[model samples]
Target chain A: MSVPVCVLGLGLIGGSLMRAARAAGRSVYGYNRSGGPVAAAQADGYDVSSDLGAVLSRAQAEGALLVVAVPMPAVNTVLQAIATTARDCPLTDVVSVKGPVADLVRDHGLDGRYVGGHPMAGTAESGWAAGFAELFRGATWVVSADEGRDPVVWAEVARLALDCGAAVVPAESQEHDDAAARISHLPHLFAETLALSGVRGGNLTLALAAGSFRDGTRVAGTSPALVDAMCEANAAALLRVLDEALETLAAARTALAAGSTSELTESGFAAHQKYLERGGRPSITGIVPGDHEWLARLRDAGRRGEALLTLPREVS
Target chain B: MSVPVCVLGLGLIGGSLMRAARAAGRSVYGYNRSGGPVAAAQADGYDVSSDLGAVLSRAQAEGALLVVAVPMPAVNTVLQAIATTARDCPLTDVVSVKGPVADLVRDHGLDGRYVGGHPMAGTAESGWAAGFAELFRGATWVVSADEGRDPVVWAEVARLALDCGAAVVPAESQEHDDAAARISHLPHLFAETLALSGVRGGNLTLALAAGSFRDGTRVAGTSPALVDAMCEANAAALLRVLDEALETLAAARTALAAGSTSELTESGFAAHQKYLERGGRPSITGIVPGDHEWLARLRDAGRRGEALLTLPREVS
Candidate 1:
């Protein structure tokens, strides 16, 4: 039988992962540090509990693949419990930023078995009740494929992502973090600033707002605490992109003052059209684990816009 | 019967105006500078032509209200035609910015019969085929109420807006320009810069983009020439808001560099929440055109988030 799945922290991503795993016919269970989601999951007839130690012990005895599904702040405690109770189980995480979580895993002496993952799917809502089995369906799930990482655990993570209905985009931790800093975190920052400036324009501005304003500022309405953690954790990469965006914006300001916004508008429109042209792309295949150049090939595929779950391999 | 409407330009905004005015049972006809949209409108059974002079002469004979629904660059030419042909017709415009259009009207010696109007609604699409009669349904239509302006023309423009299923918000041209800069132009600038930066983050970033990236960059994909003219026409107010946005973004960059984005995120989230709380507000009424303080009261009601279309008034 396939390895049993053990997910820690029953928040949106974790709870959804458990459900999707169960839907795929894998033996899946989860743990919640809080009592509410635990009781909710229990009532829903899922295997769950608030007892961290007991959950880790069960995972150890059953040889379950332990998934770190906690928020950034709670990651350390979860890692510590896993390090003490289930030290040898294969591990992965679903945190937004991979580099920081990888570093934390290293600190907790769990890096040998840990592969980082981030599924690019969410709504404005959060918490346990806001999740569904389809949250990751047809979405891109990035799997960390850093050099020198254990190949067996990498296959396990990729398999789980595919079974959860996500197309796997295998990337190195730093590459994933850097790209996310630009595409994900940077947009959150812009949304926040736009929302703030629009509101400060007073009641007339609010009354005049239409589609562009609403869509531009939509992500600013996300949970502040959640936004803060994801943005702050990838500060280095985010700062690089922020500086570039600021430079472009300042140039737009100069262009506006000089009686023409053509230069910025033209380039910006071209870039936006390029982004819009990325739909319905075909996924690449043939790369597989247990090959000498598998990691490099997988990462290259992801960079070239391919979301291929690697060819089936014998996981030792 | 309502006032006969003559629209100068059969592009999206102007064509939509002609359709909506006719749908509201007004006697509406239009002129197009180009032959393509004229033919398309004619195919749709619209009363449209490429003969600007003939259209204005017919408007003069019928004493129809004139709507200058051209882009900013074409405003002067259309106003010149009105000055030469239909100089006494009550005139208004659907251009994005108001102050510049008003100044152009004065330059063309057609200011006496002019009332600045802008329907705060449109899609990213342009040209005749992209418009429909329902484009402005339930949308805000800002009608300029500058002091010493002709009240008769203002009522004509406001009445047309109401008939097109839009709520009217009256303000001075400069006030409208200022608020438009903050709520509209600045967001466009932000979307442009953010889209440019994200695209530059390489292929992996583009592949990883989700809803936030798509929504934040949506308006950036609008027609670049249209965006440029609207933004460039309101340069003064746009520059001021752009500077303010830059200041906030610079502060966010500093916060991200300093290892905490809480300050920016918290305030931004609060601002976004405030914008969200503006739905279903009651429209303030009892402000009529013939009252002693009608102009000031209308402007006040607009600033207080009311979009009452005003009470009916007699026109001499």
Candidate 2:
């Protein structure tokens, strides 16, 4: 028989997991603090309830795996609850940031049965109503296991991610946080900073707000509270990455202000090289060498820095 | 009879203009330096050609309104060609930025016949191959005209933007540049900067790079040269906005570093208010004083920022 699954906090992530689990022929139980998401999940033909104890009891009885999908601050409280009442079941989480959540699990002494998981998939929409079975399709899901986590549990989590059509990438909690700081969190702050500036600039920007502005600000429109939580939870890492971005901006600013194309080109070349190296594994610093033609282009770009290199018209 | 429209360049913007004009039952002529686009467009049943002289003679014979949709560097050359060849025709341009292009037209003494128009719509894709009749649908197209521009020419240009499925917004050349700097050009720079950082931080950021990374970097993958040209052309305005963005980011950073939730919350609340005010007119500044409930929440947020404000669980 397929392993039973219990999903805690039946909002978007939890509700979707419940559906995907049931669709994969696994017995699933769900718990929520609020009645609405539980009701919506139930209405969608899943077994869910607002009764946390009942859900935990079901998971313990079935020896199922539990998926914690709650916000950051609430994560520790949920872990404590799981530790006290559902220690028999293995556990994984779906928080955006991993280090803090992983640390919480460690502090609660649930590391043995717990693995940290973050499915990098979401729409601008949220909640149970927004949950879809294929929401994780073709997306990357990061799974981080602390030292000595059960391999069986890790395999089960990887299986779930794959079953939901997501690519599973293994990582450590701090590694996950650092990576997300550069790629996800930093972009949010950058966009938020820009959007705020646009607002402060008044009518002119609003009038001219176009596709680029809308696209750039997409993540900024996420719940400010959530953003605050994320920044606060991952403060140190995010700030470090934010500093790097600021430094880059400063370099560009100095170059622009001084009419120094050479300085600007160094910055631009650094950026152009990285852009060409996308989808490869990212390092802490410097462009990764991949694709010979791409590297040659980077070399050429470096050689031609700031001289106003126009591409042949055929490119456009 | 409706105005005769001649679109120079015959690229995506120019081709789209021809298709949109034809769909609106207006006579359209297309001129391109490249034989390929001109031949392809002509074969596709457009009134297209490679002979600049023939295009000029035809427009002169029929008294056409000229819309130059060439790149920034090429705009002056196109304008000069039109001045010496199709001098009688009323001219407008669809370049992205205005001040430099406007200055060139002014210096060349083509201001009376030249109205600076930026039909604020484009896709990641380019060229005649990317042309679409609906490219400008529901878009805001700014017509940057000055006291030096003729009223008749300005009205006709407004009609053209409207006929292309865009709302016509009027502004001075400098105002257009400043606003585009804040909204369009600067955002591109920010996206590129962030995207490059992610790319450079490759191996370290691999597991962390997810949907947010992909979404934020979407514009970075756009033609770097086009973006660079945009930055170069609108350097002064972009530089100003970049400075403002730096200040905004510094305030946030200072708040974060200083451990001041009050300052962070204030900035965040202000950002929220601006988001709500986005897509409105260009005159309103300083959060409009209404919506007591929303204001109260923001004020409360300022006083006590919630670390985790999920959408009410019931909504999910």
Candidate 3:
């Protein structure tokens, strides 16, 4: 029989992972710190255990893969337990940030058996109730494993991502952190900043805000606790990107102050117009080109029906 | 019989006004500087003319109301011609910027019969082909008439807006400019800045830019000439709003650099969350409260049916 996959935390990411794995016909198990998620998972016909020792012992005996999908703050405690109990089980994580998680695994001397994974997919909603089997489908899942690490462990982690209907993108931890900081973290900060500015104008400004403003600040409506964790976890990388963004904004301000519309409107508008004409898809080196090929392999491996394996439509 | 409406310039705004007025069963005539838009407007069943004198003479004979729906740079030229030809014709403009148009009217000694108007609606698309009868439906159209201006003239201008299915918002020229700068122009500047930044990151950043980034920077895709004209026309007010935005962004940068996630994430998220919870509508003081009543009156006055007068759904 294929090795079972055990998910920890049972929150949005963990619960979704369990569902996705099961949908791929993999034997899946789940564990949650709270009884509520465990009971809910059980109700959903998922095999979940509240006892950590019982879950870990079964995982070790069956040589199952373990996925730690806990929040950034709770990752350390889970890591400590994993290092002591399931030392030989291949493991991965589904966290937003990778550097810190990689460091934790190294600290526990479990780096050889661990890989840092992050699925760039989620809605503003959270918790088990918000989880869905197709959350990771057609998403870009970043796998940050050390260059010299065991290829088998990396492959196993990639297999999990593929089973969830994702395209696996391999990168160093630092690279992943930097890119995430630029595209994801910094946008959240800007969204918050813009939203706060709109609020300062009282209700009239909000009333006048059209599609552009709404789209620009939609992420600002995300839960504060989650925002805090993500921003804080990737603080250094986020700060770097924010510095670049401030420079761009400052140049626009300078042009505005000087009544130089050419800078902000001429060159800026042309560049953006070009970007849009290209369908807004950025070309990533090495990875994006192989996306279709990798997806085909993944579909063949999972044996998911054609409907489940089709590429997702590009979000406009 | 109601006074016929003559539209100057057969671009998107002018063409749309002609179509919308016609849909309300108002007699309308359109004029264009070029053959292309005039032909296109004619093909769309609009009564359009290429000869300025013919259109102006017909309007004068009919005691028609004149709407200058030209670009910012072309507004003065149209005003000069109107002063020479249809000096006594009740005139208004559909320009994005009101202050300059108001000044032009005052310079031409036509303020007595002129009101500055702006419609807070548009898509990224432009030109005659982009014009539609429903373009102004449910949009906030600012009527910037001088205080103590002729009530009859103001009523005529309000009638046009109501006929087009828009809610009339009364404000001084400066107030409209300031609010437009804060809510509309400033967001475009920010969108352009962010889009330019994403371009600098190469194609990978664009590829990874998900829904939030796309929504945030959508306006950056607007035509450069249009963007340049809008920014240049309202440079003063836009500069002021840009200063405020820079300050807010700088605060976020400082917080990020200082590892103070609370400022950027906690308060920012809460404020945004509150804004969303309130349905993203900002409360405007004078015009918003009586929207329903004004709309009803407008429909009755225009003789448009209830189906045509239905309020537009608020864009979330």
| Fnat (0 to 1) per candidate | 0.83, 0.39, 0.52
* Model 2 local distance difference test score: 0.71
lDDT for A39 in candidate 1 is 90
Question: What is the DockQ for all candidates, taken in turn?
Answer: 0.79, 0.19, 0.32
lDDT of 2 by residue, B216-282 (tens): 6666666667777777888898888888888878888877776533444446456745766644333
- Assess every candidate by TM-score: 0.95, 0.74, 0.86
Q: What are the root-mean-square deviations of the candidates from the true structure over C-alphas? A: 2.1, 13.0, 7.2
In the range A1-316, model 2's lDDT, one tens digit per residue, is 5577888887787777777777777778888888888778778788788888777877888888899988787888788888888897888999988888878888988888887888877776778998888877766677674455565676677667766666655666776677778787777777787677667655645656777777777677776676677777777777788888898889888766765334444454456455555443321112222222432332232222111112122221
Q: Give the CA lDDT, 0 to 100, for residue A156 in model 3.
A: 72
Which tens-of-lDDT digit does each residue in B210-263 have in candidate 3?
676777777777776787788778888777777877787787777767766677
- Candidate 1 residues B1-316, lDDT tens each? 5679999888889989888999999899999988999999999999988999999999999999999888898888888889999999999999999999988889988888899999998887888999899989999999998876777777888899988999988888988998898788888888888789878977888899888888988889888888898899999888888888889988888777889999998999999998999876367576667678888887887777778654454442
Error of 1 at A70 (Å): 0.9
Per-residue lDDT value at B71 in model 1:
84
lDDT of model 2 at residue A36? 84
Worst 10 contiguous positions by lDDT, candidate 1 chain A: A307-316
